[model samples]
Target: MVNYASGEAKGELSGAEYRRYSRHLLLPGFTPESQRKLRSAKVAVVGAGGLGSPILQYLAAAGVGSLTVIDADLVDSSNLQRQVIHSEAAVGTPKVASAAHAVHALNQAVHVREVPEVLTPANALATLAGHDLVLDGTDNFPTRYLVSDACEILNVPLIWGSILAFDGQVAVFFGDEGRGVTYRDVHPRPPEPGEVPSCSEAGVLGPLVGVIGSTMAMEALKVLTGLGSPLYGRIQLYSALTGDWTRLDVARRAGRAPVTEIEDLVETCGFPAVEASGAAPVRAEVLSPAEALREAATGRLLIDIREESEAAEGMLPHAVNIPKTQLMEFARGERAGVGPLSEVGDLHGAILHCAGGARSAAAQAELAALGISVANMAGGYVASVTLRP
Candidate 1:
C-alpha cells in the first residue's frame, strides 16, 4: 500500500521527478512526501473530452503513478474548442490515444493506459478497478450514475464534474454504506430524457470547461494526497456568466437505500425505448439526407429539433428552428403558438432533425404519440450537409 502521509513509497520519485516537481515539493501543505504519494497513486479518468482534458493534463503533470484514460469517442473538429488535450491534427483519432499522447508529452515519468472502449454497466467494475480514485467527466446521465455506482461498489472516491453552457458543477462522493453520500443522494432520479440538452446540443463555452475541469483535478489531488477536506459530501456550483461560486452541503438520504449493485441504467434512466437487441431498427420512412434536401428544395417543411444555439452553428438550409423541447410541448398541445408547429397547420408528415439523429428520433416518437407522423432526417444535419449530393 502507498503511504500518502510521507509520499515515500516503493515507487519513490527519481532525481528527474524531484526536479520536475520541485514546486509541489515546496508547497507548505503538499510536501515532498505528498508528491511521492502522488507518484504512487493510480487514477482512472473516464471520458477524454472537455473536462477530462484538463483533469488528465493536470493529473499526469502532477506525476500520478499511473493514469488510465477511458473514452470511446474519436476526436472531432468541434472537440478542439474545449477538449484541449487533443490537437487539430488529432481530430479523427481515438480520444484515449490523443489523451495518452498529451499525458506522455506532459510527463514521461507517469504511466498512461488508454482504454478506447465505452464504459458500460457490464464492464464498469473491470474497467474502474485497481484505481485509487475515479474522475468522471462524462457528459451523459447514464454514465455518471454508472461511475458513481461503480465507485460505491469498489469503495473508491469519485471526483465528478459537469459543465454545460456557462454553468458547471463539481462534487466528491466517498465512503461506504452509512457514512458517505453517493450521487443518488444528490439527484435521486435522473432527469427526464431530453429534459436537459447535452453540451453538444446546447453548446458550452470553451473556457467554462477549463475552469471546472481544473477544479475537478484540484479535488482529485486533494483526495489522493489527503491535502484537505476533499469536496466529499459537498457540491460546488460555478457560473461563468456571473463569475460566482457556491457550495452546498450534501448528505446521504435518510431512508434511501445504498447502491448495492449496478442496474440497467438505460431503462432506469428513462431513455427512449429501443430494440431488445440494442440496435435501433432503421425506420424505412426516414429520409436520406439527399432525399430530405430534395424535399426541402421543393418547399417541404424540415424542422430542426436541435436547440436554437446548436442550430445557429449551421443547420440544414430551409429548416425551421423548433427546438426539441418546444416541439415536444407543441406536440402535446400544451404550448400553442410557440414553434413552427403553428405554421405546419397539421403536424402530420413534418420532417425533423437535430445535430445527430437521436433527438430527431425522439421528436418523431413524441409527435407519433400525438397521432402525428413525421419523417426523421437520417443522420440529422451532420450527414445531411456532409453527404450533400
Candidate 2:
C-alpha cells in the first residue's frame, strides 16, 4: 500500500511546529502521520501571478517541505492588485525570484526553488518529473494544456485554478492517474482566435483573485497529505458578487480521447482555428501589431496583461489591467469596473499583449470562451511598444 504518511508518525513535529500546526494535527484526518507526508512531499507551482500568490503563501505557511516555482515574467505595478506574493518594493524583480523570497519569508523551513524561465513544452515533462503533485497556477491555455499533458504523461495530479473579474474555478485533474482526465478533457480545444478578452481589455476585481487562489492552495494541501476527499475530476466554480460556488462534475471518457485538438497544438500551442465540444468560439476583430500602432483606432480593445508595476513602467494608452493568468475566469465572469458590461461587451474584438507573446496569446483563447473575438499582439507588448514607440 502507498502510505500517505512518510513513516514518521510518532514524533514528526517538534514542540514549536506542533504548536504552529496544533489545530492541523488535531483535525480528524490530519494526524502527525499526515503532517509528515506534507513534510516529505514536494510541489511545483507553474506561475506566480494572481493565482500563484495564494497557492504559494499558504502552502509555505502550512509547511509544505519544498516548493518549486517557475515563471518567466517580471513583477510590475499592475500585478499588485491580485498577485499577493510580491510587494511594491519587489515590483521590478523577476516573478520567480520575488516569489521564492516571499515563500522563504513566510517560513524558512519550507524550501522554495525559483525557475525564472517560462515553462515551455520542451522542458515541461522534465520540469514536472519529480514533484509529488504540481499546482496549475499558469495564466494561459498553451501553458495550461502543456502542464496538463505533461502531468498526465508523468502520472502526477494537477491542482488547477483560473480566475477573472468576479468568478473563478478550481479542480483536481488527473489525480487518480489511471482513471482521471486532464484540462484537455474538460475544455478540449484552445478556442478560435479573437474569441475572448484579455485582462487588459477588461478590468478585474482585486479580491476575487484572493478567494480563488487561496482555495487552490487549500486544494493542494488536501491532495498532498491525504487530508480529505480531493476535488478530483470535479470543478469547483466561484462567483464573488453573488458569493455562489458551484461544482461541475467531470469524468473520463469511456475510451476515446477527451480532446480533438490535441494533435494540432503539439507544435506551437497557438491555433488560429479551434473547434471544441463545449461551445462555439467568439470571433475577434483585430489589427496586426503594426496596423494597431499606425492607425491607433482599430476599435480593438488593446489589453496589456502585464502587472501594474510593469504597466507604470509603460503601457498602451487604452490598455487595461487584467493579467493573462486571470484571462479564462475573467472572460467568463468579469464585469467592467467603470462601466456596464453586457453580452455584446463580451463579444468585442481585442489585441492581447504581455511582455512578449506567451501570456497574451493564451489569454486571447480564454476570452474566446466568453464570446469575444481576440488576437495576440504579434510581437507581444514589447512588439506593440516598439511599433508605437
Q: Tens-digit lDDT track for model 1 on 275-328?
A: 313345333247777898888889888888777787788777788888888877
lDDT of 1: 0.80
Q: Over the stretch 88-189, how does candidate 2's per-residue lDDT look in tens digits? A: 998677888888888777777776777888677678878788999999876566778888878887888898888766778899997355567788778766
The TM-score of predicted model 1 comes to 0.79
At residue 152, candidate 1 shows an lDDT of 89
Q: Where's the lowest-lDDT run of ten residues in candidate 1?
A: 1-10
- State how far residue 305 of model 1 sits from its true place (Å): 2.9
Residue clash pairs of candidate 1 = 6-33, 7-33, 7-37
For model 2 the TM-score comes to: 0.70
Where is model 1 more than 4 Å wrong at Cα? 1-11, 268-270, 274-304, 307-352, 356-365, 371-389
Which candidate leads the pack in lDDT? 1
